[model samples]
Target chain A: MQIDWFTFGAQIVNFLILIGLLKRFLYGPILDAMDRRQASIRDRIAEAESKQEEAEQEAEKYRSLQSAFEAHRAERMQAVEEDAEARRHELLARAREDVEYLEAQWREAIERDRADFLHTVSERAVTETIQLTRRVLDDLADVDLEDQLVTVFLGHLQNPEDALAKKLIDAFEDADAEVTIRSAYELSDDQRERLLEVLEKRAGHSLTLSTVTDRELGLGVEVQVANRTVGWTIDQYIEQLLDEMLRQLEADLDQRLTADVSATGSMASVRHR
Target chain B: MEISPDQIVYWEWRFVTVNATLVYSWVVIVLLGAGAWFITRNLTVGPDISRWQNGLEVLVGQILTQIETTGLRHPKRYLPFIGTLFIFIVTCNILAVVPGYVAPTASVTTPIALAMCVFVAVPVYGIMNRGLKAYFKRYIRPTPLMLPFTIIGEISRTVALGIRLFGNMMSGNLIVAILLSLAPLLFPVAMQAFGLLIGVIQAYVFAVLALVYIASGARAHQNNGEPAPGDAEPSSAV
Candidate 1:
């Protein structure tokens, strides 16, 4: 084997040229591309991390806002429930007051009706009793009721008690004191003279007297001296009887009302059960 | 048969001549340069890349990795020299499988030329990495009296580098030719196949030895005036 100097030198030069060419075409471009790719990947990773951090922050912000909104909702709901409860109580109280007022008005109307009925019945009974008594005296005793009333009044004057005598004397001592006599019917002159004589004898003085026919007296006479009066009248007896009757009627109505109230209370308790 | 491509001259003009070795070397160079230019012309810096670009990248990357593993701190600084040595030799050896194609590496003149390039590059890279004074200081390391022996060691290893590649490639070709004449079929084909494997291995061996010489020279100052690991025995059995 032999080596040629010219071939050796030419091959060396060729290898050197190949080295330069390969470097320019291969190593330089490939390495640069790889380095650039690596840098780009690194930048992308950093950007992704930053975006993740921002996303987490945003999520946290939204979470807090949601919690605040939930708390506010609960508070508002509580306030609304309280307002509703208060309104319900107010409405119930107003309804109860209205019921009580209406019940009172109804009871008052019933009481007024009962009182009017009792008054009408009492007036009719008194008029009937007085008429019946007048008819009985005229039919049985053959004496007029007015004459009897006058007789009774004269007796009360003639036989006056010690206190009555003193009152009459004191009344007669007033010189300007005039006597007014009211009767159911017009008195005969003889009856008036007799009443005057009796009164004057009891009083031990002379008296000025005025007679007035008042039909409301109902066969009774009244002698009034100033503001004082002395009389015996059927109207007074009838009034006493009507008052007793009214007391009895009121007692009955009160008892009935109490029973009705008790019954209503028992029914209300049953419904509650 | 002629042992070297230098004997097959196509033209001559006194000392200047055109021979098979020069022609085939140019052919390998053109093929490598054109292929590199074509594949890397439209190279992308993105994750997506062409298959050809991928293959080229793998090749250049492996060469860089090999240089780095040879104790060179900056592998890229030695990539062009060491990478070209491997590619050119491997391509020439691989093309020997083609009919009537004599490998340029089978020529004593081509291997001697490549060895001389490595010889020159070792000092150049060493001086560039560690100053000239520090680079030359490695010859007299351990003692100044070892200078002549270190010089002889350097020269002999360069000679060994060239002769090792030339002997292996030439013997494989010679054996294949002799086997073709004797058995003429199966043995020649098998030996040719075996020669292909040997060719690739010789390429690797040559490149690695070259990287070792360059690395030892560059790091001589860093090893505290002692020679680097491969400085004592830079030759490869392959």
Candidate 2:
């Protein structure tokens, strides 16, 4: 081997220039592409994570809305039940008031009916008494015979408990003559003693006694003296009978009236438009 | 006594001496030593001075400027190796004109020594920058099938570097010496001038080739692969 400086120098310059060209053209493209790929992958991963978070937020919002809806529904149902319960209580209270009003009206009607019945019975009794007195006056119109009869009637009327005694007592009072009284029916021992005591005080035996069981007057004794007589019986009085019948009728009518009113009111309310 | 150009002078131990060539090699040594000293002394960053600094600045500036133009990060990394090559070669080529001075670079041994140093340095730097495994693997890269051929080519290139330098320098020295002895006056001057021109050309060529070798080795390790098909070219001259 021999040294060749000329050739070596020329070769070195040529190789240097060759290397400069190769570095510029080659390697640059490959490295640039690799760096770009790395950056894009990092960005893609970040985007994916953010999207996942957004999805989760949407799911949470939907869940919250569902829960709120359920709670609201439950609250509405509770309010409806409470309203129904209050209405039921109000209806029951109205029914109880209606019943009480009917009972009170029934009692008032019974009192009114009793008062009417009593008044009618008392008027009938007064009319019958006046008619009997008129007939006695007509029969006494003949003079001597009438006087004798009147004396007898007057004697009878002196003891007013008997019908005959009450007529004799009326005749004697009309003629202004004294009268003797007698009883057809036998008197009890206590009754005889009461009659004698009365006659002795009056200076005459002038009492008439009778047992009368009339349609109007039931059982017991009657006494007559002059134009006065005493009448007593065990039967119910007209006023008392009237009062009992009126009470029963009034109760029935009042009950019916009250029931009708209540029924009509209930039907009208149900039929309202 | 008659002597022929093909004759050899021998000593003990197989040492052969070429008398004129030995003197030329000495001339090469002195010129290199002096140039190195002159360039090193009074080195300054400032401008506006003697032609020596300006001349050096041009040469160094050209090398570094080319390195900058290549767009390498550290041009100074190759400065010592490349700069030494340029200076040593320029000194070796110009030393032929000095009386009783020999150009050592004209011998096979001197140029072989320089070439071997370059071969070792390329691999060492490759391994230092990369590693032994990486530097060695550069030969087999791109395709493993081409490993044997690439290895043979690299070895041949290194051997040729030594042979080429030795042959050119020796031939030129011989021709100049022969011409000066036969026609010592104006004819010799023409031949010497021819020698000087060729000498400068050889030095530039050697230094540029050195840069190529260094760039290839360093770049191979940097690439971690063989040169691509488009990047491949014939190795430079010896």
Candidate 3:
């Protein structure tokens, strides 16, 4: 069990030298390679993080822009709707005005046609009433009717009012003024002389008188003293009755036209609404 | 087979004895150095690599992982010392299968030399990691009463590391020699194969103990930042 210090010393030196050689070649290269790999992996992770952040920012920006565009489109659509409504109102108002004008013209033409028809009817009615009266009078007349009318006229002149006497006296004062008498039938010479005396006595002046037959002065007589004349006849009585009837017919036509025009106007107003 | 390679002295020059231990240790060193040079000489920094290069890298990686897992924070600083001890011992034991070759680990001289390196390396790593004053101050920790026990524990463990490896490797050779004398045939061959297994086990045991001793000293003066060895690494990976 002897120990040799010399051999032990040499082995220690050999182990130390082997450590140095292995360290230089083997451990150094492997460790360096592992460290480089770790560094490259860290760089890649950092780049990926940066790219993710950028993509998020871009997405946010695009979302905001899209919402803004939608809002703008909605606003434009509302404006267009408002414009269309306004135009519709304006055109409708114009159409209503045209309708009102056409309604007024139609009423005017109706009124004119009604007036023309009324005029023609009134003229025919007046002529027919006058002819009917004339026929009735002709059927009922006697031989004394003419003389009776002349006598009544003479009686009026003999007992005239004061104003009538004054008018007769003024007419008699003219040197060219002559009293001319007309009758629907002929009278005798004596009757004429009698009528002249009566007139001179009633007027309180000397008067010249003339007599003639005028069938158009029907069933009556007319006298002319200078520019003044007085007479009575059946034709005048028939004409007065016809004028009253024509006036009533005109009033009735005016009422009917007024009702028709007002009713038409109400219908036109409803249409406009 | 010689039980202790030290008894076989190949040369004697003055008082410096060049025994079978020194000669065989040199042979194992040359083989290891040459093999290391050959594998590392054409290493690629890129992805494509030779199969031999891959095998060497796997071996180197495993050694570094063991040192780091034992609570040594800086594995590269300890790699030169720890990796060499493992490779040298394993190469010596594995080559013992050769017919006339003596394993250096079968001699007490070589294992003593390797254990002495671990003992000297402890203080060197502790002082370098923490300062001189802080490293020496750890000897008196718990109380000054622990100083002698701490010193004796350090020396006893170093001696145990060397003696344990020498005993295991030398006993394998002794068993094989005894079996060769009895049968000199099939039994000797089987014992020699069994000796190979014992040699690999002893090499692994020697390298792990050295790593633990070195890491314990290296981390002694450091702050309580060192994780537990199991928490730091998966033991099944290596």
Best by TM-score: 1
Winner on lDDT between 1 and 3 is: 1
How would you order the candidates by lDDT, starting with the best?
A: 1, 3, 2
> On residues B119-219, what C-alpha lDDT tens digit does candidate 3 reach at each position?
99888887898878877777887577878978898889888889888888888888888877889879988888888887877788778877776666667
The clash count of every prediction, one per candidate, is 0, 54, 0
lDDT of 3 by residue, A1-273 (tens): 456788788889998877877777766765665555456667777888888888889889999999998999999999999999999999998888797879777887878697878778887977787898898886666557876766776776666675444556566666353788887778777668777787777556677787878766666666677677655567766778888887877788788878877887877778777
Task: Kindly list the per-residue Cα lDDT of model 1 for residues A138-233, writing each as its tens digit.
Answer: 344312767777887787667657554556656666535478888878887888899888887866667787899876555578888887777776
True contacts kept of each: 0.88, 0.04, 0.68
Which stretches of candidate 2 lie above 4 Å from their native place? A1-273, B1-31, B44-47, B66-72, B180-185, B221-224, B228-238
- Per lDDT, the best of the predicted structures is 1
Runs in model 1 lying further than 4 Å from the true structure? A40-146, A154-192, A195-218, A221-232, A240-273, B142-145, B234-236
- 2 or 3, greater by lDDT: 3
Q: Which 10 residues in a row give candidate 1 chain B its minimum summed lDDT?
A: B228-237
> Number of the top candidate by DockQ?
1
> Sort by TM-score, best first: what order?
1, 3, 2
